[model samples]
Target: MSWHKHLDTSWFRSDYAAAAMPHDENGCVTGNYWLAWPPYITDDKSDPGSLDKILRRRFKTLEAAMAHVDKAWPLGEETT
Candidate 1:
């Protein structure tokens, strides 16, 4: 005989695995599942004259990152 089981596994996993990283020892991020990192710069200068392009992104939550990805297009949208 064969048996099947229905499970609610959605709670166990996420599309972005990195979102599950352990929070700080203080448990701040654990209380609120949002991790904030320092704003990264491409170069040493605050406002560089170099033509080389630089890209930076900040996400308040995983959903925000996914939303940005979904809105991104080949030609780039007016807002992301």
Candidate 2:
């Protein structure tokens, strides 16, 4: 099964942000799942261009990541 089957699209702010999740050759989930704000870029906090102001969190599973995003940002919350 594809890793994308695990995702809840409603939790994502946009497609660009959702693309942050890592995938293997078969397009199945590989590593950890992530939740982040707009203009989604690298998960590397050390990345010089990364937006520190935006909220970012990593989780072992997509469910955990979605929960974190819901708790931290919540539905109907305005994002940049």
Candidate 3:
């Protein structure tokens, strides 16, 4: 069993911006998943590029990506 075996390639958003594994013409999960933020990256009005630095900008697994996202914005922590 693998991550792709249970998921499809679709760009969706949650507390973060968008993230998904890219797919090939044959509809296969071709590579690692990518993460992205809105054009205006200053979510906390701190540093616009800070979040990207936290993300490492890539992931080989969805769980890893999610773990990083959690690190980026921890529970009970308020950005606003």
Candidate 4:
């Protein structure tokens, strides 16, 4: 019942570029996810499935990693 369990790690393989559009003028564009690691950090766009590697590499298991993230940052009230 953690965030990682709910994640489809397959989403992280290809890197993603920030939207070409600029962030809000206040720089308050919210509810976004970004790279905390590589392949992600690289100019090369991440493969959609590469995120699994990140979880496997960092948390040893998807559930543990996801739980940590959830504790640190719970989902928004309207998130679903």
Candidate 5:
């Protein structure tokens, strides 16, 4: 399998992916799932090129991790 599973991008950035879960020394999925994504970006008329996008999420199961992704990404049904 590839290292990353690419997904759609937001207006700010392109080339985004959930990244495959970390693997053990034996090359197996770990018990925990994790992801890092951008936070909400609010635009200000003064500075048109500024953003605060920092978020980290951890999940006990893959389902939970994907649920988080689903909530943030409701579009692109074909990939879903």
Candidate 6:
């Protein structure tokens, strides 16, 4: 059986939301469930560059992605 799931990433849908691309266990890209935000100047006066400029991390399962997000950005926390 194949495990499939979808995650809601609308909360972080700013100009710096992380990209979430789903992939199968076999390492094949299934679909793009989330769209990354474009590049913009941050308040620190530093350009973090666009999402395209960085290597996007692919997740084989929604749980893995959720864990990564939680670790990177905890709930009820403000992000820059």
Best by lDDT: 3
Model 4, range 1-80, lDDT digits (tens) per residue? 21221123312212221111113555552323322223223233353224553333344443444444444334432211
Q: For candidate 5, write residues 1-80 as lDDT tens digits.
A: 21233322111213243423555676665545544332233354232112322223455554455555556643343222
Model 6 root mean square deviation, Cα atoms: 9.0
Scored against the true structure, residue 22 in model 5 reaches a CA lDDT of: 55
Candidate 4 residue runs with Cα over 4 Å from true position:
1-8, 11-57, 77-80
lDDT tens digits, residue span 3-47, model 2: 233354323443333324655677675655554444334556765
RMSD of every candidate to native, in Å, equals: 12.3, 7.0, 6.7, 14.6, 9.9, 9.0
What tens-digit string does per-residue lDDT give for candidate 6 at 1-80?
11123344222323233445544676565675533322232434243333443234545554565455556555445655
Q: On residues 1-80, what C-alpha lDDT tens digit does candidate 3 reach at each position?
A: 11222245544334333446666787787766655333235545445335655255677666665455455555345554
TM-score of 1: 0.25
C-alpha lDDT values of all predictions: 0.28, 0.46, 0.49, 0.31, 0.39, 0.42
Q: Higher-TM-score candidate among 2 and 5? A: 2
lDDT of 1 by residue, 24-75 (tens): 5654334333222112223444432111311234455655533343343211
Scanning candidate 6 in windows of ten residues, the lowest lDDT window is 1-10
> Worst lDDT window (10 residues) for model 2?
1-10
Candidate 5 has which clashing residue pairs, if any?
none
Ranking by TM-score: 3, 2, 6, 5, 4, 1
Score candidate 6 by TM-score against the native: 0.39
Candidate 6 stretches greater than 4 Å from native: 1-50, 53-55
What is the C-alpha RMSD, rounded to one decimal, of candidate 1?
A: 12.3
